[model samples]
Target chain A: MSKHVAYTDFIDCEEDVRIRAKDQARVVALREKKGWLFRLLLGLVLIGPGVLVMIADNDAGGVITYAQTGAAYGIGFFIPALLLSGLIAYVVQEMTVRLGAVTHRGHAEMIWGRYGAFWGWFSLVDLVLANILTLITEFIGVTLGLGVFGVPHVVSAAAAIAVDVVVLLVLRYYAWERVSLWIALGNLVFIPLALMSHPHWSTVVSAFSTWRVQGGFTPAFLFIVLANFGTTIAPWMLFFQQSAVVDKGLTVRDIRHGRVDTAIGTVAMVAVAIALVILTGTLVHGMRGASNLDIQQILSVLGQRLGPVGEDLFALGLVEAGMIAAIALTASTSWAMGEAFRWPKSINMPARRAWRFYLPGLLSAVIAAAVVLIPHAPLGFLNLTVQVVASIFMPAAILFLLLLLNDAAIMGEYTNRKWQNAAAFSIVGLLVALSGVYGLTVAMPHLL
Target chain B: MKKDTLSLVARTDRMAPVELTKAQVKGWVRVVFWGLRVYIVVMIVLVAIGFARGQI
Candidate 1:
């Protein structure tokens, strides 16, 4: 009995301390490696969804929102306001990294397992619907972008669809992430377009100090603010990043790197958004009643103001933004569906084994493409509806995320700190209020 | 069999229940859950009314 007791004590000691200590040691050693350049390169290689989600957040619809903001309101108030949205995006997305790392479960799977089927199905339906609607907008951006160069809508849609299929199907998860990252890098084209506009740099900087909206807080101004908020953070971003982190096999050790990845993406997202705002604000805002112009009219104004080269570059940025977003949104839909239905979910899965996972996304793209090809398909209403649905659904999605983060059973020692919970809930309140105001505006335009 | 039993015993010991109570954490969740639900329902009703009145 004495001998047995001694042996059990040794085993307990090993379990209580040795394993984690070894892991901690390994992590420390890995971090202690010398050479800053090597570390940067390693981070670039390691980062995935953090960056992708941010860039993808600035999608086709988002570009138009920012452009319209510039044309309508100019760089007066939105410059700092949009910059602040980057921080909001970071705070929301950071939780996704931690959740993915600690739990090794996608958001849908976690919600379904913990929150019961009602919320699970609710989340799934919202995600799939929003994704499809968002994809149609992406196809719109692609067609319009290419149309400026005389590419027919049919040809543009087909080409975009083909490229998306090949990227999603032919490559495994890591390979797909890398390929998408390269495409995401192309989103920087807007930076140069902003620079090329040659705006009054002092006025742009001084807007930060002045910090005033051009007009007072009228209904029109509030509408644009709501649009900006809707575009910055959406339900798809939450699903996409968490699933990407899990699929990438990120563990707690990788959380720091995941954060850096997301930080880089946030910077890129806001930079491009602000650049578009600048480009449009500088060049297009001068036209009489330019705020009322549609996207086509905005593009036309760009052509007239910036000349052929600048216009072409802006168009290229729009096309790149749409294509990259399509990739992310498609993966997000596939991951969610896979989690919901118990299908194989990883981008790492071979086409043969994961066709069910890929099919939902592919079919969604095809349907969106077909819809975009329809002549005069109520694109305006579709855009407004997408915004409304996203706003209405935002609070619910955020509620689930916060609940999961706080759950002791799921998060173990990694549950949110008290302040994190406070900040997160505050954001939820703001979102709910925004959704309510948006709802009122949509339902009773006269009241607004 | 003896080794396996010992490891299982060790595992359970290492994964002892956390410091926070499930009920305590769940209190916040229930509040946010109901709150968001009420908000969504209100929004839907307003939009429905708008559509009915040709406002949307």
Candidate 2:
């Protein structure tokens, strides 16, 4: 009855939802026609958002915290703590997969739509502020990491910006995700560096059994532990993963694969953190009475103890961590804004089409990069505030997450079980206590 | 010309009009809400006291 247009002609379609639907149908049809290998390959291909969010959780900020943990506490208390965090990360992040699959909405959108404007604005404002502050720390990581290679801060910042722009602007969603995943893989570079340190395996093994704080539970010890906690689970992570799942067009069928992806990411994150702690613990432990050595000092000590190659590798890991976080955080900011305002949001859209959607993220990255270049910018103060701010706001983020996860009409059968709610609330309680203590330590040492 | 438009696989409207029902946070869930709220407030007040006294 009519002419048939090639599928490529559909590229110009304004609504991306149609493209996603058609693509999903095609995949489903292919699965029916093709054998098991094709389905296996499809399954492999579908697991991005979960893995990406988990790996990205071990961002620049997280790396520094891990290094400090290793340097300050040795492989004693934090070794088991890392494993605990991985579990916490998995339990918390798995909810996002179900939410995205069930609702097909970003965290910001869900909050605004269901919980009224006050909560919505609160979440959005907290997310954007934390993302921007954290992005600055990421740039700081990039600059400091590259500084090891004698790269100028400006040059490194510019290069980082260019790489993020290319990845964000030039590539479509699928390609961009692949690129980000590859960069995230670079985080594993810490493993070999840790091996190079030749840590005492028996001691590492005993750390699990002992679970003892080397310096006892002093104010400093508590701070590092809380810092590790703050970095492991952040407000940005919740926004990033939900929007990522929605953007990836993952259906309810894909939620299991999503959980597996998150689990993989959790393993990777824990392993890297453990390695960093061991490496620093072996090399720089008790240095300067182990009073929270700066990252520069930590890297320099690595150079001296493990030689130049070790330092360079550690630096490379830091740079990769920063770049990966920068990309994820920028996208997170964009997604939240897009979701909040109902803008056309998806990395698949061309620059011309989604400029407004992409603008907030780009601007955040740019400002973060610019702030790093300012002379005497009080970066330590910025870093401190980012951690403090994330800590302060984390409870609210977790509360909203629990609320949405438990909502019956929206989540239907996917709602969290009662035990899951108990676990989540327990985590929230623990985090609030840790943050409250850490906040006082920072905001007022006299109390401690 | 005949054109067939593919329907949205995961429609946004599914979540668009939904709002949390009244009985959402009954039982221990309500307790959790109150507890979490108090915990956050206590943390804030402690930090505020610290600031007021210039201990930070």
Candidate 3:
């Protein structure tokens, strides 16, 4: 009887083992299938933030910057300059994607944890102030763009503020991003505008091959080059992309797809920037005593050169750039505030549930709108403040980025490869040197 | 006997474990790191100048 019992127990154990093996195999198969599905879903999901961040980087300010660069320097140096700026933008933004995915933290939180409160607050203050100032410029762009069509600045500002509120508050995250992207795509209007200019193809092609600096590195040229660079990889871009990635909930596995999105955005951004330069460089530069060109001046010239249609297109592009960037900047402000204060931060959260997260953005928009309405509101001074604060905060932000990227505890096997570190470090060094040169040029314009 | 055995086990469990110290980052590496830091600072300054110039 004991032998019989032992035999029955052995059979039961063998049957259990068989069942377990089958379950394990089934689990493995499902996991494999799920991973593939997750990759596909992630590819679709991760597409928006990277592209939106890059497009927002090429804001109304950037459009004006490129237009001015072309008018001041022509196509000689800036053609290649756009390519270099695009590369720098990609490198810096790619790091943010990776950092966000690996650590699942926003730039503010990372700074707080790694460097502590002082630097964290310093970074936040810079970001908030810069964002506000930048928001003002975006509104300025919207108003000026609409003003081209005989709309009043106040009307345009109000309408723009209205549109921003509707898009941000009424829409979900996915819808908000898509709408912003559609508006951003309006920037491509410059490409057609550029084609209308009938540029010398050979000269344009040779500009790249020759890599010419045209006037041989004068202070003015250096200033323009640095301005172009600064516009491409501004400080807001870092905070915005990091927070966007966090909000999107990207994981390390999504890094490849995120990179693809970033690459597409970089290409699109550079293409638009180059086209803007081409339009102004061909039409406005050296055209019988043309000087002191701003975006308004450029539009006026385009109207004269290519008639009313050209002017209208330029205005539309400017309006789009402004509105899209305003949306992004406002959202970034809210995200940063939420991250810092440990409040619930997501477009997914309903207004009632996430009022704290939503309020900062709404208030920022209101404040910027009010500032724009005031007469002689130190527009130039505010612009300078934005650039200065962005400059001051960039190093601190990059330091935290590098620190987090290098931390094995957080990054595990995905820490930056040595070559990436080398490239990132080189970019950082070059930017610092340029800034020093710029300071000297400012202090003593005649010396350089 | 059980108490004695448990105490011995607890003492063994509490033995000090080995730890790895973080290596100091130095040489060209150190230079590169600081250089990147300075580069970022300069980039900011250039941006400020560009803004001041109001060209862009």
Please write out the lDDT profile of model 3 over residues A298-376, one tens digit for every residue. 8889999999999999999999999889999999998888877767777656677778888998789888888988998
DockQ of 3: 0.06
Instruction: Supply DockQ values for each candidate.
Output: 0.20, 0.24, 0.06
Error of 3 at B43 (Å): 10
Per model, how many backbone clashes are there?
0, 1, 5
lDDT score, candidate 3: 0.75
Residue A357 lDDT in candidate 2: 87
Please report the candidate that would top DockQ against the real structure: 2
Lowest summed lDDT window (length 10), candidate 2 chain A: A1-10
Runs off by more than 4 Å, candidate 2: A1-14, A22-30, A33-36, B1-45, B48-56
Q: Which stretch of 10 consecutive residues in model 3 chain A shows the poorest summed lDDT?
A: A14-23
Per-residue lDDT of model 2, residues A1-448, tens digit only: 1244344444544365443554455344444557788877777777688778888888888898888888888888888988998899889999888898788788898888876677688789888999989999999999999999999999999999999888999988788988999999999999999999888999999998888876577777777778888888998998999998887767677788888888888899889988888888888887785655888988888999888998999899999999999999999999999988878888878899889988999999999999999999988877877876688788888888998898888889999999999999899889887887786675667555
Superposed Cα deviation of residue A445, candidate 2 (Å)? 1.7
Clashing pairs in 2: A443-B56
Residue A254 error for model 3, in Å? 1.0
TM-score of the A-chain for all models: 0.92, 0.95, 0.89
